[model samples]
Target: MKVIVFDTKPYDRKYLDKENERYGFEIKYIEGKLTPDTAKLAAGYDVVCAFVNDDIGAATIDVLVDVGVRAIAMRCAGYNNVDIRHAFGKIHVVRVPKYSPFAVAEHAIALLMTLNRRIHRAYLRTRDGNFNLNGLLGFDMHGKIVGVVGTGQIGRCFIDICRGFGMQVLAYDPYPNPNAGIEYVSIDELLSRSDVVSLHCPLTAETHHLIDAKRLSLMKPNAVIVNTSRGALIDSAALIEALKDGAIGGAALDVYEEEAQYFFEDHSNDVIKDDQLTRLLSFNNVLVTSHQAFFTHEALEKIAEVTFENIANLSAFRGNRETYLANEVCYQCEKFGGDCPKKNHKNCF
Candidate 1:
């Protein structure tokens, strides 16, 4: 199949190219993201491969459908960018579901470890040859309560890691997985009891701004929050307020709510306009990464593999004629995967 890949990067090409021969696909890589204006580039291609940041809204989808683009293969896990309801009968949408959950789960823990151990500060100081260890003290993670929101594969893997450190795992998922030794609880209880709270939920109506001003207040004074899931899951403005007021101890974020325009790009020379993000960056306890939890070698390979498989499935007649093949973890294209939400229907589906 002939595929036009948008939002191409050096690593994306290097990794995805390794499996192209097996899939019988020739991908035309475009460096820039596929905006509505640029959606015309998908003409004559049978499929379009998109990244998380690429805007595949109504306009873009209309353009792709007009150009005879039959299917969309999302290289990442989330499909919030796509308007799935509109594309249901017109085009098929598929994604890479659970591509190396260990990669993301481990990165969440890595950010937490880096923040708590003062390793970020220590590295900066030693680079200038300060050699000061006076304020480099850090506490241990043993016997602490870690609240994990969303008991998906990544959350379960994170719980396993925390359990290895002798930490108690408190999880909050509408549908709880009982195999991980995680005790499911309410949001208030998880916030009040946890020494560390980690977020692993997808972005939906119910989960959007799940951690708001009121929820922030419920957390302990010394509690730490880590989010490697969707950015909108936590309210950034409320989080900044909590951090400024010392309501929470620390925050380690690999994803931010307004990261689409800036995360994967190099805008270091330009002045960043997001005031809340700027203010959050000023704090020493807050650590931010560019949504890179799924950048591991294993994850990249799996992403390419699953994405191609999704394309293959859509090309074949295995799925229904109205809609294309939907990824198993794709809540956007499909219904809520296995009844996690209290509601019967998915928001965008």
Candidate 2:
């Protein structure tokens, strides 16, 4: 099988090449993303494996389908970037639904600790021999109420880390898990009671900008916010306003709401157009990373391995047994229990 992997980061090539021989596919690593403009890159390929930043919408999918591309494999767990409904009958789309949840969850904890202890600022000060800790006082995480907005695998792992710190966990999810040490609460209650709020939910119509101005105002004056999930979950303008008004204490964002223009690129020479992000950077309380919550060594290895398998399995398919087929995600089996109960052939999952 000929596979073209777009959005070829250095780390992606490193891990993908580590187990390249096992899949035995003629792989081409492309530097650019899978946008409508770059869809022609996969002209002769059978499968295309993409990352989070790729534009795999209707137009891009049309190009891939017009060419020989059969399967679209997302290396990341989230499929929010792909237009599932539009691509279903035309082309196949597969995703790594669960990878190393600990990688992302632990990264969230790292951001919180870094923000709380002022370690980022302290490092800058020590390099210049300032050695000042005047305004760096931080409270312990023990007994602090942490509001976890989702109870998925990543969210559960995050709760595990917070519980280790002896923090009281409050969770709000459409599907609650009692096994995890999280007590399900209303979003309003969670916002009012928590010292830290972390968003782990996926981006949907109902969840998009879930943390807007009204919700932001419901939070405590000194509460910290952490988002390692989809960038669209929180309104960037609302967050900026909250930060400016001191309605919230601080924020650690792994993903930005408008990341497509800037992320995974080198723009150090140019001025960033997003003035809000620029202002956020000016403040010591805000910490931002380029959506690197899932960049752990172990997670990358698994992503590579699973992506290779997805390509191979997709190539080896005879007919309808294709795991990467758009119908498979909507094909609810007995194993799916009551979770995927949509038998209306809508592909709405």
Which candidate achieves the best lDDT against the true structure? 1
Go through the candidates in order and give each one's C-alpha lDDT.
0.86, 0.85
Residue-level lDDT of model 1, residues 1-349, one tens digit each, is: 7899999899999888987768878789999998888889999898899998899899998999999998888898888888876786677687887799999999999999998987999999999999988777767899999999999989989999999999988889998776666688998899999999999988877799999999999999988999999999899999999999999999999999989878999989999998878988999999999999998999998988888887777667344544424573334424545553533322333
Candidate 2 pairs with clashing backbones = none
lDDT score for residue 3 of model 2: 87
Cα-based lDDT at residue 107, candidate 1: 98
Write the residue-wise lDDT of candidate 2 on 160-248 in tens digits: 89999999999999888866656899998999999999999888768899999999999999899999998999999899889989998
Model 2 ranges off by over 4 Å:
321-349
The number of the candidate with the highest TM-score is: 2
| lDDT of candidate model 1 versus the reference | 0.86
For candidate 2, the 10 contiguous residues with the lowest summed lDDT are 322-331
